[model samples]
Target chain A: MDTWFYIADLAGVAVFAIAGTLLAFRKQMDGFGVIVLASVTAVGGGTTRDLILDVPVFWLHDATYFAVIAAAAGVTILWLRLKAYIPLNRLLLADALGIAFFTVLGTEKALNTGVSPVVAIILGTMTAVFGGMLRDVLARDIPMVLKSELYATTCIAGAIIYVALSSWSQTVAMLAAMTVTLVMRFGAIRYGWSLTVFKEHK
Target chain B: MDTWFYIADLAGVAVFAIAGTLLAFRKQMDGFGVIVLASVTAVGGGTTRDLILDVPVFWLHDATYFAVIAAAAGVTILWLRLKAYIPLNRLLLADALGIAFFTVLGTEKALNTGVSPVVAIILGTMTAVFGGMLRDVLARDIPMVLKSELYATTCIAGAIIYVALSSWSQTVAMLAAMTVTLVMRFGAIRYGWSLTVFKEHK
Candidate 1:
């Protein structure tokens, strides 16, 4: 079980790091900037969650996360010539999977720490969304979590579902929650679904 | 001593909240957006520091910080009518004071936790600058700490001074460090001191 969890975690890190590196590339950032963005996008959400939960920061204790981010970043830089061949949809799918995995993991961690259901759901959503938000902010773009599709909303809904089903088997609840989050996100990406924009009235 | 610290902390919160609210107003964000910006700008740095130190989030345990932020935001909203009369320099001064106070306070807290001096100084600088960085990011502006002025450098220098002088009386060290930070920041504001911008080569 622990091995599976670690594998999922590393996969998420790699996906987010690639996304961040691509963004930095798009923004014409230098090599150092690309690495910084990749590292932050890979670990920022979990770091925020751990801080809020008063736990040891995940990346600080485990060097594997950093190694994964560095490896992903290297792959991204080396694949610069193949950028035109890389499908956007595939990136989106990887991002959705990462969000789903992180949401369940964060919600379960919060629940284990004895926080209220509401806070757990919120933290879970934050944990799933904040990394992307940080990446966008660093890249000088508006955070997609704040404006695009049903990103954060999907995480929140999945977290609430996970909490509500806590009386059932933990593994079953986790799987169910991850499925819901991924489906919602993928649906949004496929269908161009989005939350309403709040334009200011003049 | 504790009372004085609380007083200074609240003052810093009020100043940063007001600055955040005014920025939100300029960005034409709604009331909820204004409050969110204000709250994050006031407490974001210290909250970040506490999280890194693995300590209980300060605002979670105490309601006063939120109350102070609310009051400051309210005042800023009401003072919008008198915007032209509000001197920008005074706001800068308040911001300078906030950086000084937070730098010393964060450094002391990190030292209390037995972190190495270098880590303490870095954490202290983070505590001093991250709130403003968050505020700018939320307002969709590049962070001042990253781009302009001697802001974060002042905090770093002050934190180093505090740590180096730790063998001396804590009170004297704190006061001296705060004074140095304030002087450097005020000098920057008055003389238009700034770090060199890193323009990307075409």
Candidate 2:
């Protein structure tokens, strides 16, 4: 269980790092800017969570986590330069999957640490969303969560399912959570669905 | 004492908000982007500190703090068209003073709350500089603290001095810490003195 969660964390960081650095490259930013953006996007959310949990920074102790982010950045930057506008659709899908994984992992971690269920859900949402928040803020773009898109809603759904199913084995709980998030997110994107039904007021 | 600290916290936040929003505007950021920068700049450092210390977020509870930051941004955006530069230098001086103030306040708060003096000093340094860190990161610039400019060093010096002088009256400790930071920062800016002295290897 621990190993699976660790793998999920690294995967999330790598995907986030790639996304941030890719954006920087698109903006024609220098190498240093690319690295900074990558670094923040990889660590910003968990760092926020760790700090709030008052846990010693997991990344500070685990050097490989940092290495993966740096490696992801380097690879993504090179890849971006090599390929022209490679359908950003792939990157968006990867980012969505990564967020879903981290969202479940975050709630599980928070609950394991004995935080209240409400706070656990909030933390899960933060874990899923804040790296992108840092990425968007740094890139000077509106955070994807704030857009009409239902990004945070996905995390919330995943968190609720995870909490409800946590009494089951860890693997089953994770599978249930991830399943909910992935289906909802992809379905929403494919169908252009939304919870809000407000018509155009203007 | 409590009243003065609250006022100082407000002042620190306002200064940070002004600086952050101005930078965002300089880049032609939209209204939401401006608010993002302002909020991050005002609360970013303390949020980082709390996360590291594992405390419940003070800002999440205290809406007034966020309100003040919004007000600052609103004023800056409105008045921006009128002034070529809105006393930015003077406002920066105020910001410097606020940094000094927050450093001492953070240290004292941590210390009184039973954190070790060393940890208190770390928190102090965080409070003093984390806002600027968020600002630079959002602006897509490497944090100035990690640069040749001796920003973090000055913060460290001020925190150390404040902790050492804690036995004295509050007025004296505050004055001494503020002077140390102001003098170091001002001298660095005026003389272009930097801490990045590289030794020449023979």
Candidate 3:
């Protein structure tokens, strides 16, 4: 189970790096900018989580995450140089899978830190969504979480489910939470679902 | 000296909160959004620094910074409701003053953590510029540090000065560093100075 989780975490980092690189390509960012954005997208959320929990940053201690992010981003740039076409739809599906995995992973990590359940849930959601938010912001776009769609909502739901089921079985809880997240995100994308934004009147 | 530093830190928080609220007003963010941005702008950099330094977050330990930020943002909102005109120029000056102070403070804090000089300089610059970066990101604008002028550069220069002079006298070191930062920032604003952005060509 530990090995599986480790693999999933690395896979999630690669997917996120790829997603961030694609976005940077759209912005026509320089190579350095693309790499920076990709690295932030891959690790920003987890770093923030570790910081808030007052722990040493995972990447700094392990270094594997850095290696994966750089490799993923480099491959992405090279692939894009060879082929101009971007399969954004497939990337979105991969992103959904990544976020689901991250949601459960983040919740479990926060729970281990002895924070309250609600704080853990929020931290879990942050772990899943904050990286993408940082990516969008650096690209000078409004964060998808703050603007439209159920991006954060999906993470929040999955985190809540994980917390509720944790006393039963950790593996079952993780599986169920990820399934719920993936289902909701896929449904939103397939059905063109969106949350209504607040209207401000002067 | 500790009392004076605490007061200065609190004042910096208020100034940063006001600066953030003013920027949020330009984006026409709601009250809640205004407060959120203001708070992030006030503490984002320091929080990042503390997290990296593996220290308890200053605000989490003290809470005074939070109170100052809330009060500052609330006052700015009220002032704007009564007066439609924004003193953006003056606000820039105040921001310069705030960043200068924060640069020295952050450098000192990082040094106290026993990090190397280079890391201290980076952390200090992050402490001064990161909050504004977060504010710009949340507002869906390009971060000023990344986009235009010598924002981060000023902070960096100030941090370097602070680190260099630390072996001399802390009080003199702070004043000299702050003066350098203020001069650079004020010059950049007054003379319309900017760094040449790297152009990417396909």
Candidate 4:
């Protein structure tokens, strides 16, 4: 089970890297900026979570994540050379999958640290959303999670589910949370569901 | 002496919070957004450093930082209501002072953690600049450090000075580094010093 979880985590990292690379390319960023964006998108959230939990950063402790992100970036570059096109919908789907996996993983890690469930849920959402947030910020765009359809809300819901169910069965909790996240995220994208924007009286 | 350092640290937090509040207000952010921006700009960099160093976050361990930030924000709001204008030069001066103080403090903390000099300098720069970078992102503007004159460069210079001189005399090192940062930063602002922006062939 640990092996499977680790593999899925790496897969999630790769998807995030690809998504970030595509966004950077769209922004006309040079090579250095492209790699930085890809790396931050893949690992930024996990780094934030580990930092807050006062743990050794996962990438600094294990080189495999960096290696995987590099591989993903390479593949993305080659694919772009051939096609010169990446559909926005496909990128969103990839991002959704990564967010679902990361949300559950982050919540489980927070729970293991003995934090309150509310804190765990918050950290989980942070883990899933932070990298993308950084990516958007660096790209000089309003973060999609803040502007788009139900992005962070889906992560929060998935994290809440994992925190609520983990005591009963870890496997069940993980699976249920990931499934629900994917469904809600996909539904939001398909239906264009979004929370109301906050506007103040001038 | 420790009490002096503590007081300076709180002053730095207050300056950062005031700077963030001013920026958010320029964006017409609501009261809640203003507070959020102020808090993040005051504590975000230190939080990032603590997380990276695997140490307890200072603000979480001691409430004084939060209290100072809140007081600063409150004062800025009241002052704004009365004056209806804040000069840009005053804001830049406050930010420069905060950056100089934070760079030395962060470098000292990293050295105490027994890290290498390079890591200490990097962490110091991060501690000084990360909050402003975040404030810019939240406001949907390019970060000043990335685009403006000598912002992060001054922090790096200060951190380097602190790391190089601290083994001889801590007080001398702190004073020397802070003075150098202030001189360089003010010079850059007065003379319009800037690094060349990276551009790639299309």
Candidate 5:
């Protein structure tokens, strides 16, 4: 179980790092900036979660995460010159999968730490969204999560479902939660679904 | 001594909350958004500090901080309606003082936790500036701290001074550090002191 979690966590990191690196390229940030953004997007959410839980930060205890982020950034720089061949939706699809994995993993970690189910769900959503938000903020763009989107909502739904299905087998519960999150994200993208914004006062 | 630290911390919170509330008003955010920005600016730095140090979050143990932020936000909202009468520099002045207090206080706290002086100084700077960074990010603006400015440098300078002066009386060391930070911030505003940015590649 631990080994599976570790693999999923690293996969999520790589996806986030690629997304962040791509954003840096779009923003025309320098090489140093690209590496910084990639590292932050790959690990920022988990760092926040561990800090809130008053535990040693996961990445600080291990060097593998840094190496993975560096490799992802290197690949992204190479890919930037050949951008015409890549479809934009490929990054979005990878991001959706990354969010799903992070949401389930965060919820499970919070539950194991004995927080209330409500707080656990919220933490899971935060863990899934904060990295992307930080990446956008550093790129000087409005965070996609806070704008008109179903992004965070999907994470919230998955986290709640995970908590509710805790009585079932751990493996089954995790898979179900990830599937729900991924479906919601893909559905939103495919159908252009978005949350309604409050009308501004005249 | 503890009482003095507590008082300084609350003062910092109130000042940051007011600054955040005013920014929200400028951004034309709704009431709920104003409250969130105020709360984050008031406590975000401290929360980051505690998380890094593996300590229980300060606000989680005390309700007073939240009440203070609420009060500060209410005052700012009322002040917004009477905006023309208020001097434009009031918020900047308050923020300067808040940064100074938070820098010294955070440095002291880090030192108490047995971290090396260099790490303690870095933590202090993080405690002083992260709140404002979070506020700007939430408002969808580039953080002023990361831009051409003397903002974080002032905090870093004060933190270093505080650590160096630790052998002196605690009260003396804290006061000296705060005074230095406040002077640097005021001088920067008065003289338009800013860090030079490296020119972007053409």
Candidate 6:
């Protein structure tokens, strides 16, 4: 189970790096900017979680995560000219998957850190969303989370499910939580679903 | 002294809002983007400081900060047409002053939160620099702090001086810290002084 979680983390890192490269490339950012985006996207979520927990940053403690992101950056650099050949939709799917995995990872980490359940839920949601927030801000897009959307809602739901199901096997809990997140998010994207809480003052 | 501090905070909020508007408006951001930038510039530093200290977010509890940023955003919306007459250099100076005050304020808050001195200094410097980081990332500029500039170093030096003299009267400590930060930053800008640590390895 631990091995599977580690693999999921590395996969998420790679996907996030790819997303960052795509954003930087779309913005015509230079090589340094590409690397910066990749690093920030890959490690940004974990770093926020660690800082909130007052722990040594996981990437700082373990060289492997940093190495993977750097290698991903190198790949983006080498493939820069051929980037147009890549499938944008596929990359978008990977980005969504990364967000889903991160929601679970962040929730579990917060629980382990002994943070209160409610704060843990908020932190989990933040952990899943903030990297993309940084990316959109850098890309000059209105941050996607602020729109009438179901982004953080998915993470929050997953966190709640995790807390409720922790009495089960850890693997079962993780699977159920992640399934809930992916289903909710993909459903929102597929059907043009949205939350319209803001009403006209008139 | 409390009144003066609040006045200074209001001044900082105004300067930061204009600066944020400049960056966002250059990208042709819509009203929502404008508001997000204004809110982030005004409250991001303190929110970050509270998160690091594991404190309830102050802005959420007190509506004053939120109101000030909102009012500043309204002013920015009206002033966008007059932007051509606005002096960018003067705005930059005002922005630097905002950063200086945030640094001291963050340091003092962290000390009160019972964090260690070293961590407090780092938090102080982050509070000083992160608004600009958000601004630049949203503006798609390579962050100013990543340059060889003395931006955060001013905050760092001032934080050390602040910690050294923190036992003195709070007003005296604040005045000394602000003086050091302002003078150091001004000298750096005037002489194009920069930290040696950022010299590239190539």
Off by over 4 Å in 5: A29-33, A70-80, A83-88, A187-192, B1-39, B52-54, B59-129, B137-202
Evaluated against the true structure, the overall lDDT of model 4 is 0.85
Taking the tens digit of each residue's C-alpha lDDT, what string does model 6 give over B58-138?
Answer: 543344665677677677666665443445565568677888888888888788888899998999888778887776765
Q: After aligning candidate 3 to the native by TM-score, how far in Å is the CA of A87 from where it should be?
A: 14
Candidate 4 regions exceeding 4 Å error are A29-33, A200-202, B1-39, B49-54, B59-129, B142-202
C-alpha DockQ for predicted model 1: 0.12
Top lDDT hit: 4
- Total backbone collisions, model 1: 0
What tens digits encode model 1's per-residue C-alpha lDDT throughout B1-202?
A: 6677678788888888887776666565652456656777898999899878978876654667777887888877766744524466766776788889899888988898999999999999998899999988866888878776798999999999999896787788888999999988988889877777777578
User: Each prediction's Cα lDDT score?
Assistant: 0.80, 0.76, 0.82, 0.85, 0.82, 0.73
lDDT string for model 2 (B28-126, tens) is 554345666677778878877766666666564455786798798888776775554555465556557757777887777777778888899999999
Candidate 5 lDDT, B60-160, residue by residue in tens:
54668877998988877776665523354876787898899999989999999999999999999999999998988878877868873789999999999
Which ten-residue region of model 5 chain A has the weakest summed lDDT? A193-202
- Better model by TM-score: candidate 1 vs candidate 2: 1
- The per-prediction i-RMS, to one decimal, reads 5.9, 8.7, 5.2, 5.8, 5.6, 8.0
**Model 3, stretches more than 4 Å misplaced?**
A1-46, A52-54, A58-133, A142-202, B30-32, B200-202
Residue pairs with colliding backbones in model 2 are: A51-B51, A51-B52, A52-B51
Q: Which candidate is the best by DockQ?
A: 3
**Least well predicted 10-residue stretch by lDDT in candidate 4 chain B:** B27-36
DockQ of each: 0.12, 0.07, 0.14, 0.13, 0.13, 0.08
What CAPRI grade goes to candidate 6? incorrect
Q: Report the Cα RMSD per candidate.
A: 6.6, 8.3, 6.8, 6.7, 6.4, 8.3
Output the worst ten-in-a-row residue range by lDDT, candidate 6 chain B: B57-66
Chain B TM-score, all predictions listed: 0.90, 0.89, 0.94, 0.95, 0.94, 0.88
Against the true structure, what is model 6's DockQ? 0.08
lDDT for position B194 in model 6: 70
Instruction: Sort the candidates on TM-score, descending order.
Output: 5, 4, 1, 3, 2, 6
In the range A1-202, model 3's lDDT, one tens digit per residue, is: 7787788889989999988888877666642456557777888888889888877766644557767887998887777777755776866886787789889988988999999999999999998888988888788778877774888999999999999998799999999999999989988889977677667678
Instruction: Please tell me which model should have the higher lDDT, number 1 or number 2.
Output: 1
